[model samples]
Target: MTQQNKIRICVAGATGWAASALCKAIIKTPDIELVAAISRSNAGKNLSEVLSLDTEKNIPIFATVEEALQVPSDVFFEYTSPVIAKHHILSALRAQRQVIVGTSGLTDEDYASIEAAAHDSGRGVLAVGNFAISVVLLNRFAEMAARYMPHWEIIDYASDKKVDSPSGSTLELVSRLAKVGQPITTIPIQDTKGYPETRGAAINHTQVHSVRLPGYIVSLEAIFGMESEKLILRHEAGSSAEPYVNGALLAIRKVQLVKGFRRGLDSVMD
Candidate 1:
């Protein structure tokens, strides 16, 4: 496609790990154009200088989403922190820009607000916690397993730098699983021993255990306790951010066809 026909993208958090990989991916993609790069810390610096792209061309970095949206784009990618993701996404939606959110700190209520904004503006938003296709399938299978085995717990592992406790993927998984059916409603919560905190946080009737430590990039496991056998569904990620690149690109492309809010990359997948 020609330059004018390419999908214009404005990336928030352009200097972060996932955004860094996404910027590189967009640089090589023929049908996408990097119109605006939003990074408060790297504001006024050239994208080539910050990301070290081979091209001598410089992409302007804006300090805020409001400033970045001034450039006009087809799609907005939210790769910023949880604190600012809702604001950035709402701004983009109110401006009638389709958005793909890669941020993980948002709650279900936050998404509900985003969905309402998108509905009012008649734009689209795709949000995913872990973008790898394997992770998506893992969440899908966990939902299926939740139906037959109603006694499952989710364990999410990530590096120390990860702010969210359960992680976005775990939250999504638990939310989906709860929809299949309430987990063993007959089991009484009062029967638990010791401190209640020992059992981990209860989300949508499922327990979610989070482990944050150094050396680990990211990992998620769904453990189902049964009478004679147990079923375990797990997904692990390496140090590099490459796993999320393809999924992010897919969301960017798919956002064009969708209206309102769609959660997970699996929603758009055939």
Candidate 2:
């Protein structure tokens, strides 16, 4: 594709572990262009310089999302922390740029506000908790199981360094299952004899347990049970960030096709 046909992108947290890999991919892709980046630590430097990417074009890096918005772009990729992810997304929408969100920890309240902003701005926002294809399949499969099975729970696993409990992928799964209906619990937490917390936290009316430890990148399990049978759907990610790059790229290309907010990669897969 020619330069005029390429999709311009500005990536927040461009120097982050996962975003950096995406930046490299963007530079190499024929139909996408990395126009600018946001990184407080590496601000005022070229993206190619910070990522050590060998490219002829000079991609400017800005310290703040406000500064990055001044540069013309088609999409703003939010890969920053939860504290500022919503703010950055709102700012991008207000700037009339489509958005692809990879940051986690946004609450339902946050999404409501984002949905309003996107509608007002007439732009689109695509939020994906985890961009791995297997995670997408897990979410779809879990939704189907929720319709047939009455009892279920979720287990979220991540590395110790990951601060978010009930990984974003698990939260997305919970949101999806909530549409089907709440899981049936034979014994309520309030009815438990003791140590009710051991049963796990209730999220969207489904019990969710989070485990943080070493030797795990990210993993999610949706367990469904009946009187004599049980079914488990699990998706695990490895150390590499490669799994997310393609999904993110697809979101960038398809986000403009939507007018408001959308969640999950599967929303655009079709």
Candidate 3:
């Protein structure tokens, strides 16, 4: 995006944890503008109060997408829960706006629909499991290992009581690995006696062990083993939200540059 042509954006579910962080990121980016923000529970409240924004502009809130889409925006940041993401993203696309979807519940069917919409509208749809640049590089590393090792497994970690068994990051990584080939073997933890399902879920013809503990933001390690040698690639996210901000900005700037939907964080990346 050029300096003069600021990318106008609206962040849906504006009061949530990730959406609030996204709004703050948009606030500081010179190349982007928060044209609109919507949150039903926080309607009529100030972004400054909820997110501690220093700027003194009267930012109005809307109760729903129907209200928010009355005003147009260049791009829409869809950051609600999985239950609402599919409908919210489709709403933005129907409004003829580009999208940067950060929410996780999108299945393959949902993606196919978004793909059709993006192609028909001649806009871009960018979906990312995790936006950290180091995570992107870790995926690249896994892709590279697939070329030679062809024997890597993915393991992703999250907090306990998180309902999702396999993480979106792990699913995304294994999906990429699927583009390469089937792994050599599959290990089923259910066959073991201790902890039963404690070893985690499996995906893409490979073993993906899920770890849920209290103190982690998000972390993953890809393990490749063969001939008495092993390759490991790992990335850990700190609580600071700044790293993800740049990628979000990148998606907003680069959204209109593509013709259709993009599945991975690396697709629209330069």
Candidate 4:
């Protein structure tokens, strides 16, 4: 593709742990152009310098999404914290830019608002809780397992420093399984003999347990049980951010194909 025909993208957390890897990949990608970046600490600096890349492209960094939107980009990539993610996405839609969301911790209500904004603006918003292909398959497999098995629970594991509970992947899994069917609960939380909190939080009629530790990067497990047999499906992420780069790139490419909100990477994947 010619330089003028390339997909222009502005990434909100361009200097973050995962987004930095995506920014590097975007620079190397032939069909995508890194137009602008949003990083409060790295504002007024070039993205090439912040990422330490040997490229001649002059990608400016802005402290806010509103400032970055001034560069006339075609796509907005949100990888920042939950606190500002919704506001950034809405701002992007109002700015007439399609969006690909990589931030987690947004509730269903948050998505509803984004969906409405995208509809009014006639822009597409693809929100992915987890961008790893393995996690995508995990969600698909867990949905399939939910059809056969009636009892299941989710175990979410992440780094100790990560603030989000249950992880975004876990939330996505819960939402997916809810569409399949609500898991069978034999003992209601109210009827529990001991502390009801031990049963974990009930989200969308499914029990979810979150574990924050030092060793884990991000791991999700779905355990399904029927009378005598049990099936466990799990997806774990490594130390590197490479697993998410390709999936995110795909989202950036396909987000404009639709006019509303899409929830998963699998939504655009064949």
lDDT winner among the candidates? 4
Winner by TM-score between candidate 3 and candidate 1: 1
Question: Listing every candidate in turn, what is its Cα RMSD in Å to the true structure after a full C-alpha superposition?
Answer: 1.3, 0.8, 2.7, 0.7
By TM-score, highest first, what's the ranking? Answer: 4, 2, 1, 3
- Point out the worst 10-residue segment of candidate 4 by lDDT: 49-58
- Per-residue lDDT tens digits for candidate 4, residues 72-119, read 899999999999999999999999999998999999999999999999
Q: Which ten contiguous residues of candidate 2 have the minimum total lDDT?
A: 163-172
10 residues in a row with least lDDT, candidate 1: 182-191
**lDDT digits (tens) for residues 64-151 of candidate 2:** 8999999999999999998899989999998999999899888889999999999999989998999999999999998888889899
Candidates sorted by lDDT, best first: 4, 2, 1, 3
- What are the per-residue Cα lDDT tens digits for candidate 1 across 175-247? 7887797666345666776676877888888878899999988899999877888899999999889999999
- Give me the displacement of residue 227 in model 4, in angstroms: 0.5
lDDT of each: 0.88, 0.92, 0.78, 0.93
- Best of the two (2, 4) by lDDT: 4
Which prediction has more favorable TM-score, 1 or 2?
2
**lDDT at 210 for candidate 2?**
93
Judging by TM-score, tell me the better candidate of 3 and 4. Answer: 4
